[model samples]
Target: MDDVYVELAQMYDKFGISDFSVSFGDSMLKYFDCMYPNETFKKNLDICCGTGTLCGFFKDDGIQTKGVDLSAEMLDVARSKYCDVEFIKCNASEFNDGEVYDFITCTDDALNHITDIEDVKRIVKNANVLLRDGGLFIFDINNFDILTPGEYNKDSFNGYSKLSLVQSRDSDLIKTDVKYYEHDKLIWQKSLFERDYSISKLTQIFNREGFVLDSCSQHFLDEKRSEKWKLIFKKVE
Candidate 1:
């Protein structure tokens, strides 16, 4: 499949998706802190970490940070934005660094983009291998339970860009259409397709990969949007 983020990277930062990532990550990390009281997160790895915004936020908080993504174009943007972050280009399911981290995050429903169940399982296993004992891992997903054919979602980023999505009524696929504008002049347009993963199946994979579900929330920045979910897991084995 073609790399969607790479095509969007040129105009991605203008959309302020980075800000949403940090804000969402703050909520998720706070939940992690509450779940694992007294746990100090010293190192973090953001998987499928686009634009490295969350990693940048982590760096600002004095945490050692690294971000991994498959798209080199996206990494170029991330590196330019946050030079301090150890941005690596590799498939999330196949990423491995010699060092283990105390905290790991995969945000923005990135997991759902993997259409293969085996690859998703590999990503979960990699998380277990990447985290230290009792480390916390947080990730978000677009809920599969309530997903229906023809479901549509859209969001605008302060007049810089607009993203529109529509789900196929015949399959678990989603078609994303994004338009970027510079001073009201259309600059770029792109379309991409993604598949949504079943939440129950993902939980089962997490169990087999040595992770225990620690928390779950449907809130996106205080909005109770049941169609979205963020789950926190702990490495227990």
Candidate 2:
């Protein structure tokens, strides 16, 4: 499974249809600046930092940043392009360090990649351990309501780039089957699995992990879509 994730991670930036991190990170930085006007974040970490997309944003903001993922191939690409930032290949659910971070982010719905509730608990617990007192943990999840409704299994395109997506939802599992074809040739295909959690269930997990929910907003900073929510959780003192 780890090797498969690594292979997908290596080709993600090249073959994946969406570049959500660029826009998502932009919004997060704005939120961070507005919410923490006087705060200074020296060290930051991006868990499940596939291709280091968000790490680029942190670097642009002059924050000393590091990235970790279970995919060594992904880290290799990130290291080649962003040599200044450190990249660690590790499992999100079991990572630890003697040092803690001032800020941490796990974006692109990476949390959903964990298909088990216990795995989610372990990952969040590890995140808690990696964060300083009062440090922030930011993440996002696809709304199960929208996902289960079968709206995601659609054919869409952005000019020349066409995307064919298939979604399967079960009692506790959500799977996405994606096939990307370009120039009439099949370029990529991947099956991604994630656990389904409501906003309330997510809140419960965060509270149990001793974190405060600062904000939860749906969609790309817009309420109209309301199909996905980005949440910010802060470590308690």
Candidate 3:
């Protein structure tokens, strides 16, 4: 199957992904409130949403929220967890539901997961279409520093279940080796890939599609110190 999360989806929520998503969603909500305190976001759409944890934050604020992802298994997990948030199965690059939203998010460094840069462009362009005029498009991507030649390793255990993750970066590509063990027996192992394009290049591409950078942050807006960057763009008329 093309969906890499087929097997991983079963154990994704138990792997601290949901916990991290809380902080991630908090960051977005904080930024939105800061930027548009006088106004309230009416609708939100999260592309590449995994388990709909991020959508919960918007839903809590009474905003109509929806999530989209390419993996059916991931969507299944999300649907089971978040009954209030609508979930759709489709590639972020090709999704066109003819519905407009006030805010669009594709966080979690999801852009890097698309290997083809053209698809990344398509995703951003499509976001522009799905966003109403003056709508916000927020997303994050791995920066050049993280996409350089490097290696990272980690191992974790949840009771009898163990997970080993080895991630490496060569040039612009990041490859991750994943191994899951259950009760001392290997259950599944695979390699996943991600690619990162430079922030400047993405800026130019988004600009061409009538999106202006509204804000960006690593630690602070316009600060470029961190390895991953969250960017906010406004769709222009």
Best by TM-score: 3
RMSD values for the candidates in order, in angstroms, are 3.0, 3.2, 2.6
The list of candidate 3 runs beyond 4 A from truth reads 144-157, 220-226
User: Please, what's the RMSD in Å of model 3?
Assistant: 2.6
Ranked by TM-score, top first: 3, 1, 2
The sequence of per-residue lDDT tens digits that candidate 3 reaches over residues 1-237 is 235598878777777655655666677677777878986678889998888878887788777899999888889999998887889998887888899999888877778888888888898888888999889888878775744544442334366887777777777777878788878788888888888677788899899888999887776433336677878889996
TM-score of each: 0.85, 0.85, 0.89
Against the true structure, candidate 1 has what lDDT? 0.76
lDDT of 2 by residue, 50-150 (tens): 78878977898788888888777888888887888888988888777677898788887778777777888888898889999989888888777765534
Candidate 1 lDDT trough over 10 residues, lowest sum:
161-170
TM-score of 3: 0.89
- Clashes within 3 Å, all models in order: 0, 0, 0
Model 2 lDDT on a 0 to 1 scale: 0.76
Candidates ranked, most accurate by lDDT first: 3, 1, 2
